[model samples]
Target: MLEATIPVKHKVGLHARPASLFVQTAAKFSSAIKVKNLSANGNFVDAKSIIMVLTLGVMKDHEIVIQTEGADADAALAALKSLIESNFGES
Candidate 1:
C-alpha cells in the first residue's frame, strides 16, 4: 500500500465539481483508492465513493490522507497527488 497526506488548496475545497473530478481520476486506476480526513475527526472513505467524500465535508486547508494498493498503486498515487496539488484545476 502507498499513502500520502495532501492539503486542500482550492478556495472552495473538495466539493461538487472538484469531488466529481477526483472521482473520475480515481476510477482510472486499477488500484484501490481511499481518502481520510484526519482533522475532521478521523473520518475515512473510499476515494471512488462520492457519497463518502461528501460526507467528509472537506474544507480548504484541511488535510486528507490518501492511500491505495494494487499493481499501479505508485502511479495512481502520484497522479492523485498531482491532482490534489493542483486543487483539481478548478477556478
Candidate 2:
C-alpha cells in the first residue's frame, strides 16, 4: 500500500462540490483507496464513496491520510495528492 498525509487546501474544505470531485477522482483508480481524517482522531473511510467522505467533516487545513493499495496505487496516490494540493482548483 502507498500512503500520504495531505492537508486540505480548499477554502471550504472537502464538502459539496469538492467532495464530489474527490469521489470522482478516487473512482478513476482501480486501487482501493481509503482516507482518514487525522484531525478527527483517525476514522477511516472509503475514498470513492461520497457519503463516506462527507462523514469525515473535513475542514480547511485539516490533515488527511490517504492510502492506496492494489494496481496503480502509486498513480492513484499521486493524482489524489495533486488534486488536494491544487485546492481542487477552487481558488
Candidate 3:
C-alpha cells in the first residue's frame, strides 16, 4: 500500500467538479483507494465514490490522507497527488 498526505489547494475545496475529477482519477487505478479527511477528525471514505468524497466537506487548506493498495498503488497515488497539487487544474 501507498499513502500520501496532501492539502486541499482548490480555492473552493472538493466540490462537484473537483470531486468528479477526483473520482475519475481514482477509478482509473486497479488499486483500492481510500481517503481520510485529517482535518475532519480523520474520517475515512472511498476515493472512487463521488458521493462519499463530497460527504467529507473538504475545505481549502484541509489536509487529507490518501491510501491505495493493489498492483498500481504507486501510480494511482502519484496521479491523485498531482491532481490535488495542481488544484484540479483550476486557478
Candidate 4:
C-alpha cells in the first residue's frame, strides 16, 4: 500500500461535482483506492464511493489522506494527486 497527503484545493472542497470527478478518476485505476482525513474522524472513505465522499464534507485547506494498493499504486497516486491539485479542473 502507498499513501500520500493532499490538501483540498477546491474552494468548496469535495462536494458533489468534485467528488464525482474524483470517483471517476479513481475508477480508471485497477488498484484499490481509499481517502481519509486524519484531522477529521480518521476513518477511511472509498475513493470510488460517491456517497462516502459526500459524507466527508471536506473543505478547502482540509488535508486528505489517500491510500492505494496494487501494481499501479504509484501511477494511481500520481494521477489522483494531480486531479486533486487541479481542483478537479475547477482551478
Number of the predicted model whose TM-score against the real structure is largest: 2
Q: Which scores better on lDDT, 1 or 3?
A: 3
Query: Tens-digit lDDT track for model 3 on 1-91?
Result: 8889999988778887888999999999989999989888757799999989999989889999999999999999999999999899876
Candidate 3 similarity to native, TM-score: 0.95
Computed on alpha carbons, the lDDT of every model, listed in order, comes to: 0.86, 0.92, 0.91, 0.87
CA lDDT for candidate 4: 0.87
- TM-score of each candidate structure, all chains considered together: 0.92, 0.95, 0.95, 0.91
Q: Higher-TM-score candidate among 3 and 4? A: 3
Output the number of the lDDT-best candidate.
Answer: 2
In model 1, what lDDT does residue 36 have? 92
Error in Å for residue 24 of model 4: 0.5
Candidate 4 lDDT over 20-49, as tens digits, reads 888898999999999997557858988889
Candidate 1 lowest-lDDT run of ten: 37-46
Clashes per model (N, Cα, C within 3 A): 0, 0, 0, 0
Clashes of 2: 0
Residue 10 of candidate 4: its Cα lDDT? Answer: 85
CA error at residue 79 for candidate 2, angstroms: 0.5
Q: Compared to the true structure, candidate 4 yields what TM-score?
A: 0.91
